[model samples]
Target: MTTIDTREAAVAGLALFPPSLRISALESKNFRDEVGLSVDAVIQLDEIGVAFRRSTLFKNIRALLSENVASAEIIDRNNQSWNIALDKEKHGIRITAAERTYLIPDFSCLHPNVDNRLAWFDAETKRHGVSDEDLRAWRRILADREIDDEEVDGLLKQFRLTPRYVSAAIEKSLRRKNIRIDALIPDEVTYFDRLVGKPAPEHDLKQFFEHTTKERPGLDLPAAFLLSSHSFGPQSIALEAVDPAKVLEFFDWAEHAGDRFTQVGVVECGLRHLHKMPQLAPHLRNIIQTIRSDDLTSETGRLELLCALIMLVDGELARTGICRERQPFWRRLAAIAHASVIERAIVAVNMLPDDFIAWCRQSRGLHFYLQTFVDMRREPRWSPDLLSASQLKAEFIGRIVAAAPENAGTMLGDGSLELFDRASSSSLVAQVSFPFSFLPGPLEGGQPSIATMPQEIEDNLNEMLRSETLTAKSFVTLVNSALLYPLDGEFARLAAEGLARAKYELPNIKSSDEAFHLLVGLAIVASVTRSAKLANEVKILMRAVRRKPDIEISQENAFRICLLAAPASAGLSDWGKYIGDCATELSFEDMSRDSITTLWNFIEVLRQLEPTLLQTTSRADAALQAAFACCPPEVKTAEAS
Candidate 1:
């Protein structure tokens, strides 16, 4: 395979990673020594295994591995299967799945949203109001002083601009205008842009700054740093706080400040404390309806107005603090949000696509929420929308939770799956509590024989097991046969404890399929160790196994007994017969061919080690025993308890 194909394969492999791996960091040595070494063999995409390379997906996967995302999906768009999402994690251009399960890309890394920064800049300007930060930043860059990373980060926070945005502004100012990039970018009021060279009737900007900074104790601004003597103030209005009693007075002066800056400043004050003044919501809504489209479209104005609108929308609006006020404005938002199709509803409106969806994230209103989006994507959602007024409540919550990793628990009623595709190791680990269930995959290495897997992941799994934090699903995923299995004894302990705990929890799990997985998990534990306690637990699962046998799981159970108890096998002989009974009862269609072959292999091996019990009289069965001639004399079966 070419470099491109190898990288693509590596990415697909990443899809199989556990939720923790998708949102956590991994040491290079651990990944290379452990996960890296084993990944190629189990890649869901055959091409990834054939053309796989370590270097291809490592760089981009590093970032995706560390941060949270709002949405991650394998989308077939424009004739390409691309992985896209609204990334909230750190910066990067592409995402590569280490599991190689699906071909996809991370959205933010696509075309760097730079150079084209102005596309959104114009819209952002109104929402933020015109600040002299750009002009101030340009002038500061000319200072020729050394600047470091902290200062650069400060520039982003202070400007509310992306790193990309700040970088571009700095490039334009310094490379084009001989300015220093280290100079501070302003977050201050932009009352000076229109006054670059004008004669105003208000007070002198310099004197006013000095007087305001000296007299107003609470308003102790730099006053001297970014202002020029030529700059002038609007009217004689002084800056004031957003007091509930002085609300009307504030707006009065804001409108008459002789410049748009004061007007925007008033809007900012209202936004900061809008939640406290619910009575004023109606008035604010009126104000929005009256603002010019251009002003409402600017970035600052748009964001501020949206903030105010968000505060007015009813019931646990996304991002903003909750607002239960179902006002007429919500209807307007709904109308703006309406569409017959989920994607079309969001795409139908321009200007506020994301904002509209974000606001109705928890709403039950039909137009505001749709069931289709949730059905389209498999992820975690926060709530049930108990009232059922909206169909997409689950999807709504999922989008937000996917964006915020801190809120993942809201969706994990059972540790079945996360929002994205995952690799076999992570997926298997996730199902660790269920035991013999993870059987039919291509994994051939069993404990003590396998070498690949990072120490960090092993340590992490061990820690989770020791702490009893590993979920039952994760437990079963960690304890598979052959190629995919954990060497950590803590995992075994956790699996034992989990099996014990499962007896009480089984009734709570309504799905028979899920319960069967738990039963299979017990059989696996019994096969791997000599603990009487675990053996007793296996009896509990065995008595509880109400469903017809899952052949693959049964095959795995037999294979494990042969692998662990053969050659001087003692306590496992009966369990081996038990496993054999389940395995032999399976019809071809009832199990995967691979599993049938595996069962045949294990039965032959066990017959060699314990010939008296397993030897067959049937000629066909004897013929099948030919393949076991080279079976290893020693197996890793545990000492009998």
Candidate 2:
């Protein structure tokens, strides 16, 4: 055979070394003579692995070497040479007259002791010819506990085994010790990248996870590892291969056996991978249900779970696109964002750390905040801590203002005013007496009394009415001044007409501030003038405000507006019933002084308007009695009257 032919055979034979094996081993003249090939020929194959050696083409080259024939001649007569090919699989080593080629030696054929097996691994790893097959053989030999785990780890690191073999080693280690799989593998990008692609590593990962789950059951390590691997490490394709049923089973186990934090982490992982496995979409409700059912122990955990649920819903909405609101899932999500859940969420938002709050902001957690504000305002027993609920409302509105400052006026006016009107009216009447102080005394015919506006205020109102450049802010200020002093019939008509002009010019006044003012202005004018047109305008503006998220308007001005507007806007029939329902539903023992006072104001207003309209159930009466006990002597005396 020609030198080229002999060199080709040598190159093919040497292309099987693992990274731990030194290439310099082929440099020895004695080794070269023994192998019957040039060092250059062996150097060419250093990067190739044993899989290349097992190919049929490589086997044909081997047959040529065995026959002492040139590679060209063997290729020319492919059929005859293929038929003459030896079974290269029988042994990892082959010896011929021209060369001795080591493929992947069987270390088990030698002594089975720890020292001997380790020695074999060390020697093979140092030579220029170790292959992945050799690493596998070493793994099998070490699986018998012949070597210590430290030795296995050391060998794994020293030999630089491929991820597949490393995974095998990891699986074996897991079988012996409850150690993290990540601890066994190198934290190198290349190692993880290779691990992601290989089916053998994938299989080993699956087995290790299954073993860990079966043995430890509720340990978060497996879930954590999966999250890390799927999110930041080499995105494990094996995660997609994980059975949907298995994932569901894990969810079940996690729900019952895991802590709040672990359960949140599991759900987060599921959400992160939901796009890849849409089968998980249906189970999201159950996941949220699990979270909702959890004890209100860890505020941080509760916030985190809520954030995860928001992300899930956001993703679902984005995935489903424009028609999402019409779907059942949309309705379900709406239900999930219910008042009780929002109440807990509000508490969490109030108490959680700023970093978590920042995350919520970044993740659009304000959606939940808005939902809560809208839903809770309509509930009778809105919040146990009315003070906190009030603060949360301010915070929510503040965030909305901060997020879209330019649109604040229009958004708030159109969306928040009416909602705020209800709460503010309740709060204003319940807690303060100034708004109701305008009423005639109980001995003086029990009627609301109106007072003339001061000349200074009337002139300012006239100036505002005449000014063409009047803004919503200016309109609000003028109306507020008028309401504070009490509007006489003539001034109230002029103020109502001015409000009409402001509404016409500032048609886009959707701000909460503006809406609050406009609503009160309209109600005041409607009551003072007793005009159907002005009352209808109040209703129209109210309907517009109600179209947005709910807010409560509770201040002196709102009370004046409600008291003035109720008669002309129709009657306190609806308002009275709502207040009665709230009184019945309220847990007076849990209410604050301000909240109890607000409920009392609601009852007082109802009693003044149409006593029969305020239907009192026994529960409501008891609630009112309890509320009276918490009040000052003056309040109890007033209630007696």
Candidate 3:
């Protein structure tokens, strides 16, 4: 073969050979001569992992030892034939010319490990022949020249360049000069469009994305932009035509790439290709399941990417097939930002119901999920879908009361608490189980001692006791609210003890604001349970505190004391009479609608116990009827029997 023909064939074959390995050189040319084998025949017989190697150190040194050649002028350092060697005698494969010996892989040549393998290979192959700078220099000289095949072959043999390497060098040279992929991959942007039988204007990436199909595999978008995109961010590619297995690889790169711009490109590319590629669904689902804030470098960046991915995947999953299969993915994502109990309660309440119900079904998970659900309910704005997917069954309530009733107090306002009396067939709450209590008063083992409890539980109780406005965020208030639907007397007893504790602290309370706050919580529980001792203590404390004119009582305090008339109407007549007399003096104007509703609940609960007491207390009844009389009231029954 001619020099150009031989070099081209050798390069193509070497590119296909396993890296750092080559065909075995069984014997030297002395043996070949002894066997009378021709050079062409020897070359033909070596296709089975047996062939000439890289660099200039060939097994047959006789080929380069021709008497016509002299000096290093005949040597090409860039040649590949010398790099692959048997090293059978530990001297490595060697070529001797005159007084010099060339080794198949001199210790000077670096063999790259896997991590740096590609870059090392690219560098080694491009090092001696021509630098990238020379590649640019050559491109500039050849810019206006139209070379015939003979001239091109002549240039290849002269420069010792493979056509493929020359093409790559030319692309890199142009790409460095112009920061665009078009300068790198010279194939027309309309390649896919033409293949798919569509036509579009030049370099229209959107049209390319639209017309590109798997049946017509084309150039890789990432490969084309690898060198060009360093100036801008990473380039985004619509990946409908990408192999499905590569989708995950793309995401992995996006997640772990050190450059922020590169990561941004990956997210953008994945989003652009999202719905157009169904193969990405499983990966997206897995992300939803294992969503974590710490995976990304920046929290804000993570949130931005997460929101975009969710929005894209949400559109993709609104169906009844594989889409329906990803329901846990959807439900779990409502809490993607906050997966723990405290954060979930204050931040991800929407996801609570599903987790609560599902976890409650597991024998081992019962207390963990239930405790978390109710604890979160203690936070404000925590209205949920009433455990909509599961029924409020008797056993479920029984399991709760039996399992983690201390947390049940947190479930005070939930409709499922009503189910302390009832059951259902999806899950998530309706009923007044007046005979049941979520959290019974201080544990029967005695007043809850903080010393022995878990630090978290102690923290929760202390937090509950702290009141906002002596109204909201009150442990007593929330627990008192739960007291109204006591499934047992334990809740009332608990409130009574809390009231006693407040009464002990009453005389020392420096602020009038703090003076009578605990009275409201206690009075509510007293009215629910008709506890005389709690009522007497409230009345005595209120009367004594009023004597200290600076320690005036709140209107809510008076209102709650008065609302007690319903339960105390007959048996506790003296208590009802005292509150009825105090009612007309306090104003209801500053009361919040929520507080008002709570008061009305107390009054209504009383009315159910004894409506006549409210009627007899004309002043209290008149104020309530006056305020509510102007409202467009809904027609509703009082309560269940």
Candidate 4:
């Protein structure tokens, strides 16, 4: 036969089967690789055969091949007929059917095998041309026999199957051989090597880590770090079973390596496993060492790392049951850590249990408690279930007072008093009763000294008093500062000037809350110092309160106004009216413990100011009783004296 006739015979042979099978056969690695034909070349040949069959060209070619060769009819599983012709030497087979006729160009390459069949199914699936029948047929075939890992890996390399197919194939192979992940543990390095850079499915990686960790009992930190570096989710591993020594070793390497990504991953892993570990001291030390060794000022991420570690340690300590044993480590951390780090650490410890706070109060000195409260006031996100801001301030200040009652006045020099004033301003309704009595009392012979007052306080007071005219706010601030600091002549002088300015400004103050704060400050100053000028100013502010009777007031402010008015017989009726208004607005249903304490202090102050009023005014009596009902039993007992 001529070359044209032979080429025509090849075309007639390939068209005997369905297009899917024909495409698969041509694309098979066994066929294409042996023939040294590129996939594109095979695709081109298939397209030519398809074109030849669609036209009348293939029929003529098949007839010419048949005249020169002998043929036999074969049927496929679909019951499709195909005529097969063999050459004289039986080296080549010619296929002829009504659909088309083609030659099996080479029997050696086209021969069907398990690998080739799988490749065909994979190709069909990739092309989106595989039918349900074909899928079920291949599934049954894959299910019935065992596919070794070598063959599966070979198929994956030859034809990059989709993730779903890869997962199913791996799962099936694992089942057929009854292979456990533990069985592969010895060759894990080899397994990871083979699959790491390849398009290995996530399911395979997840399975490897899961089973390997289970079999090994502790994490292989280096291997996990490696995988995580390659974008694997390290969190998928159960880190609770990790060996602390291995974690330390990982940190040692991470510290020297200076690989930020790996360091962060290891830190996160440590955090996740911290609470689960039986002992945390070693891990805590290692983490703190890592934080200290790193220069946080060089990078923002390092600061974030410090914050994360603080959260981890603080959260662990907040678990009351576990904090006692861990207290020394936490205290050491606070002592030696950087100032910013300690500040963040203190902010996070706001949620510590009451016992922990008390222990801290007893074991730690005044400077520690003072710094903690100062740091807490600066933190915007500070919220603790155990204590509100006001309560925390009270607790800390109470500690300072108990430690050095005589030097409590010295806190004004240290800026603690100013912090107190700012805290009170921020959450006015939640104000706790500070022991102003701890401040220097009036001397029997002379005026108190202002030498210890903070420079900022002195500067602010001097600047305000020097102004041409003080606003109502300035006057109120002056009075509040006077109330918090020692009752020095300067403060009393500022208070006098503020009251003198308020005599004009109080009439124009429209907001009842604003007017009430002014009144409360003036009256408290008047009562404490027994200043006739301030007392007259308080009376004028009270009249302003009466003029704005239609103005609304919060229950807390109303109580303050009544507390201030209770001592004066001339203001007694106004005190009862204010209490009546408060009774209607007060609801202790969701009141915080600190808020309840504050309200109880108000009642106590009223009782001290005018004991008879509580019994005489029915509404005032009822309000006091309701407030007592809501007061925590300890609060009632503590303040009863």
Give per-residue CA lDDT, model 1, range 274-342, as digits (tens): 445444434333332232222423433433333322222222121121211222222212211111111
lDDT of 2 by residue, 597-624 (tens): 6655554443433345446434665676
**TM-score leader:** 4
- Which lDDT value does model 4 have at 388? 27
Worst 10 residues of 4 by lDDT: 377-386
Q: Which lDDT tens digits does candidate 4 get at residues 1-641?
A: 64555434545666788999878876676664554433322112342243222122233334434355354455543456666665536544566668676665322212235464455456545553223332455445554554432233333333232323333343443344433322211112222222222222332333544553444423445434433321123455565556666665655655444233344444445445545542442433344244324443442343333333333323322222222222222221222222122222233332222333333333322223222211221111111121222332333233222322232222223333332242455321123244332232111011222335567877777777656666665555556554355544455456666656655443456676667667666655544443445545555555445546665555565544444433222243543444444433443334555655555555444343334445544454465467657666654535655
For each candidate, what is the lDDT?
Answer: 0.33, 0.40, 0.35, 0.40
> What TM-score would you give candidate 3 relative to the actual structure?
0.21
- Model 3 agreement with the true structure over 38-106: per-residue lDDT tens digits: 232222112122333222222123222222322222233323232233243553334444455555432
Off by over 4 Å in 1: 1-449, 452-456, 459-471, 474-477, 480-482, 501-504, 507-510, 521-536, 545-611, 614-641
Q: Which pairs of residues have clashing backbones in candidate 4? A: 10-103, 11-102, 12-101, 12-102, 13-101, 13-102, 13-103
Number of clashes found in candidate 4: 7
lDDT of 2 at 401: 22
Q: CA shift at 422, candidate 1, in angstroms?
A: 18
What is candidate 4's TM-score against the reference? Answer: 0.24
Off by over 4 Å in 2: 1-452, 498-510, 528-531, 545-564, 569-641
* Total clashing pairs in model 3: 28
